[model samples]
Target: MDLSRRTLLTGTAVAAAGPALARDDAPPAVLVSTWDFGAPANAAGHAVRLAGGSALDMVEAGARVAEADETNASVGLGGFPDREGHVTLDAVIMNGRGDMGAVCALEDIVHAVSVARRVMEATPHVILVGEGARAFALEQGFDTTPLLTPESEAAWRRWLETSNYAPRANSENTDWPGGASDHDTIGILGIDAQGRMAGACTTSGMAFKMRGRVGDSPIPGAGLSVDDEVGAATGTGVGEDILRVSGAHAVVEAMRAGLDPGAACRRVIERLARLRGDKIADHQVALLALDRQGRAGGFALRPGFTYAVTDAAGQTRLVRAESLFS
Candidate 1:
């Protein structure tokens, strides 16, 4: 046979190549999302990615970022004020290892959720709130910024210029205008490949809300849930009803009872709906869940609810909830 350059090249390539090079290794992946307001909702996913941190670290860091961002308008300093025009903050954290922490109705602390994490780790109690929460934050050396941002101050100025009421508007429909502020919440659920989990939630009360009004953020099982054996869940929506429903815990339990992540979320939603007689179409909640296998799913009433999630394949994407039940 006559030797040719092409034949020589083919033989050399086969000889140099190894049999083990069949598949490329997967990069990291995360699924991120949020409600109408953005920013903080997806920030947790970002923190987790940067640190390769567990769910607990991610949730705390994400919440602190939102709490510190003046423009977010939902969780921290720049959030709309209560009826008297004062800002307040709330936060909570939980680990699947049976540790929990929270701070509610806090004021002036730039990173309320971080303070709450310290309480969970350092104190004997699982929750703390109000003046005591602030005192602890100060004692811990957490920095304090002006309670109101320029955006928030301008919002307040407009409120003063426009009307006597607390600048309340209908978040869902301005025409039907009900509450004064969004009182929206931010939560996270972190899961490791070993099946460990952590969760956190943060928010300011509804703007121009009744003085001393406390929501579900400080309540366990309402804001978030982490169960090393079953799965983890984080809740969003009306706080009181969520607490009553034990929303996140219920979602986790549903998974324990053989429900898939989607079905588990729907089951909890159905429970909430049923509690309200299933009559009010406006009732809403959102959730994300991950099993030991890293299989994940999400559910919500409307089209826009979203969660940030990371998978073993190293693919990260934003997951907008759909009516998996319907």
Candidate 2:
């Protein structure tokens, strides 16, 4: 049944009148989203769904899966490092309850952001950074690894051999009128059986980032934003502009304004395009939204992005531009 934005937004009884109510093996109705498919983020989502976990649990579990995979350059484990060769990680988690937790400029500990959640639940702070974040991870019994791996070392070594030291436009060095450029990061959002919303974002930060640069991944309303009463948004590309645009929050609010997920994502991208006219090449992003009713949609500046949803019949599939745009 194709439901209009008006019906989806205003009708409080959609579950009783939609396909979601008829499926016997609904599989918790989880949807996983990321900028790139065949990446760690996708794998993480698959793992969580198979484990019968909540969307927030899936996001954290999936992020950890990404952090452990060495092949993904944008996320943890073997991801890019600073000029100093430290592979610091940044992560954040937000629950439907509006309580949020994050770790920024973290090092040595994989899944550092998950540790931040432990802190969020055990302590009173909403954010943690640097040495403090690392110490907390250690206390939580997270095994310490030399944040840098041989593969990342080799990649950096090869990079140094080239003259690409000039930072990209989206690097934190940019001096824009409103906000600095943001960096690439892995972001995830999921909706579970209980209609609860949760989101998490993780990244090794920008390549050649400053020794301690931290971007929007761990900042609420920037890298990731979730409102159970509305929808959830996760941002990719320049976190700085994402922060100024409040890209994720913008999409969620747009949804509230009656825009479908695709329109909401398009609106956010259009604004960013105007902000970084000439430097638009590197100022890219992907945004995904899922309303409380289990309808899913997303938009991205670049082609080939991925987002997933479990439809009314309970079949879950990894969605990409090839299947969506074409």
> Which candidate's TM-score is highest?
2
lDDT of 2 by residue, 48-137 (tens): 656677777867876777677676665787778887778988888988788888889888887766886786687799888899988888
**RMSD values, in order shown:** 12.2, 8.1
Provide TM-scores for the models: 0.77, 0.79
Computed on alpha carbons, the lDDT of every model, listed in order, comes to 0.62, 0.67
Q: Which portions of model 1 show Cα errors greater than 4 Å?
A: 1-33, 36-52, 156-183, 312-314, 324-326
Candidate 2 least-lDDT 10 residues: 14-23
Inter-residue clash pairs, candidate 2: 182-238, 182-239, 182-240
In terms of lDDT, model 1 sits at: 0.62
